[model samples]
Every structure is written in structure tokens, then in C-alpha cells.
Target: MEAGDIATWVGVLITLGISVATYVQSRRQARIADEANIASQEQVEAAQRRAVAVEDSLAEALRLLAERGLTEAPPTPAMSGGPGAVRWNLERRGKHSYLLRNVGTATATGVHVDRNRATPIVRNMPENATVRPGESLQFLMAPTFGNPLPGEVWVVWEGQPEAISVPLP
Candidate 1:
């Protein structure tokens, strides 16, 4: 062949080789992308399985609590003995009996209700009582003919500077 023809043939061969290399590179990229997609799908499936396991565990715990006749969960204790650490409330258990509960984390010592004009006669009131967390003291309140049940009572305890008025429920 002539020199010009040989140069033209060489140019055609180089173009063909570049085209084949490009095709191969594109195929490799496509394969890598497909593999990454598959790995992402597997990760999503694993996360879904973990979520289902956690949900099943929570359901089992609730079922156990129900079987034991504990329908209500107890309150979580406070983290520290700060402003909202110590709290008290009065709950009526019966017609004459009441429960003074310490619903706080800190201990309440020397707990007593201050008597007022509208206060009823309280029986079994403990003297300088010590109530721990989640504990309660039972007392009987008898209302006379003139004085009915008080709307509220003043509660005092150790570590508390002043008496707190708790409304009756």
C-alpha cells in the first residue's frame, strides 16, 4: 500500500481501539454502580429487621406488665435533688382515710400537715414521719358538723424552708 494509505489505516485502527476501551470502561462503571445499589438495599433491610426486633421487645414487656396486674407504670425518679426533686401529694383512699405520698426522689423527713381553721380532725397522723421516695403515710380525716373537709392543706417537711399548700383532689 502507499504511505498515505498506510497512515489512514493506522488512524482507523487507533479510533477502533479507543472506542473499544471506552466501551469496556463504561461497562465496568455500570457494574460498580449496580453492586453499590445492592449493598445499600441490604443495609436498609438490616435496619428494618432491627426496628422490628425492638418493637417486639417493647410489646413483650408491656404484655408481662399486664399479666402481673400492673397496668400503670411508676414515675421515673428525678436525676438530682434540685427544685423539682422533692414533691408531695395527698390522695384519698377511702371516705375517711387519705394517703400522703412522696413522689420525689429525695427523702422527706418530719412530714406533717399544718392545722388551719378549715382543717378537719386528722387521726393516725405520724409524728415527725420519714417518707422515702414513692412511699406514703396513711391518715384518717374526720370532718365535724361545723367544719367540712378542707379544700387544701399546708404540708411541711425537713429540708423545705416553707410550707407548701397542696390542694385536695
Candidate 2:
């Protein structure tokens, strides 16, 4: 070939080599993007499966609670009084709130907290409150101008006739 023709051929070869390199690089990048997309899809599917499992577990727990509530019977008046008398306890729920719980096997009706001797005066005491076994009544107790909060208080309920001393925990 002539000298000018040889130079032109070299330039054409260089251009062809660059085009092939760009095509190969672009194909490699496309393969990497496809792999990344597939991995992302798999992660999303796994997350969806986990969410479904959690939802199913919560539904099963709610179903069991509903079934238990349906099967249980109410306590009779005869079950209370005498040996299975209504027991009471006081718990400090927060800085100003207290929970009066019936820890006995029987239900306590017309429950009242005697704030006469207590240091912190009990406020918002429900009038004629009824507390069933394992149930509690929450009330607010705050410090007055005179005395500090005590560790124990007197609790009274209907049919008991006497006020019982309940201690705080």
C-alpha cells in the first residue's frame, strides 16, 4: 500500500478498536446492573415474607385471646366473702398515680381508699368503684402541704364492714 493509504488504514483500525472496547464495557455495566436489580428484588421478596409471617403471628395471638374470653364464666357472689375475702394492694404506678388492685379470689364492690391517714392525699378516687379479681383501679395521689406520701393506706369495700390496710409496692 502507499504511505498515505497505510496511515489512513492505521487510523481506521484505531477507531474500530475503540468502538469495540466501548461496546464491551457497556455490556459489562449492563450485566452488573441486571445482577443488582435481581438481588434487590430478592431482598424485597424476603422482607415481604417476613412481614406476612409477623402479621399471621399477631392474628393468631388475637384469635387465642378472643377464644379465651369467650370460654371464661363470670364469678358468682357466693365465691366471695369469708375465706376468699376480697384482698387489696396498692402499687405506685408513677410519680403521681397509684393502682389499687384486688389480689383476692373474690370481687370487691364499692371500693374506696381512706385518705384520712395517708400523707399524700388521694385524688380522683372513684365513688363506689368495683374491682374484680386481678383488676385494678388507678387514681392520682399527690403530696399535700402537710404530710409526705406513706408506704401504706387503708382500703374499704362493701360487705367488708372494716377498712383493711393495704401496702404499697
Clashing pairs in 2: none
Q: How good is model 1 by TM-score? A: 0.49
Q: lDDT tens digits, residues 61-165, model 1?
A: 878887999978543233357665778888999887788888888766677777653346775554466666887776667788988888877788876778887
lDDT of 2: 0.72
The root-mean-square deviation over C-alpha atoms between each candidate and the true structure, in angstroms, is: 28.6, 23.9
Candidates in order have lDDT scores of 0.72, 0.72
TM-score of each: 0.49, 0.50
lDDT of 2 at 154: 83
What range of 10 consecutive residues in model 1 has the weakest lDDT sum?
A: 73-82
Looking at model 1, how many pairs of residues clash? 0
